[model samples]
Every structure is written in structure tokens, then in C-alpha cells.
Target: MLCYEELREAVDNGYIIGDTLNVVRKNGKVFDYALPGEPVRPWEIVTVESLIDIMTELSNYQ
Candidate 1:
């Protein structure tokens, strides 16, 4: 998960809250985009199955 302050800063700096951002590896040799865009944080799981599961679970919570 992205740090609270990091998320805030990102948004304040023009990054959309739900925008799927890329996670660049520490070595700067690798990077992956977990989501598309709009309010999710970094390091958040973003696989198609995971997304479906999350949506289902969230819907249940609601």
C-alpha cells in the first residue's frame, strides 16, 4: 500500500487518486502497472481475478 502521505502528495501533485501507477523496482530495471487510473494506492494488487474478488468483497461489505 502507498503511504498515506505519499498518496496525498501524489494527488496534490496532479496524480489522479485512482490512476493505476507503475511500480518501478528498486534497481530501476523493472516496472509494472497494477491498475489503470482514478484512487487506488501503489503496491495494491491489480490482477483481473483479484479485481473481481475485491469488487465482490467490497460489494458485500457495502
Candidate 2:
């Protein structure tokens, strides 16, 4: 698992997309993080459900 900022950077750079996720999709799209309607990078619909999945995995780590 990675931090939100790092994930956001990855998404901005096109490293994260539909193919990069195994979690359930919301609106048929994947997201990193964004400020809502910031002109440059408006927030996309990043689901809390998938976020839970990521955190659960991280919490189980050594």
C-alpha cells in the first residue's frame, strides 16, 4: 500500500488507471486524490470502500 500523496502523483502521471485496480469500481473509473474542482486537478470519485481494502491490507503487514 502507498500513501495518498504518492498515489495521487502516480495517478497524475497516468500510472494508475482502470487496469491498476482490483478493488470494486465506482462509476467505472479509478482515482488517486484531488481537491474538488481545482481547475488543474479536480477531485474524482475516489471510493471509501476501495480505500478500506487498501488500508486493511496495509494493517495486516509486518
Model 2 stretches astray by more than 4 angstroms: 19-62
lDDT of 1: 0.38
Candidate models: Cα lDDT each: 0.38, 0.43
> Highest lDDT: which candidate?
2
The CA lDDT at 34 in model 2 is: 33
Off by over 4 Å in 1: 17-44, 47-62
TM-score of each: 0.30, 0.31
lDDT of 1 at 25: 31
Model 2: how far is 46 from its true place, Å? Answer: 20
Q: Return the top candidate by TM-score.
A: 2
Candidate 1 per-residue C-alpha lDDT over 1-62 given as tens digits, one digit per residue, 9 for 90 to 100: 23334434554776534433444332332222233454445654444323233334334433
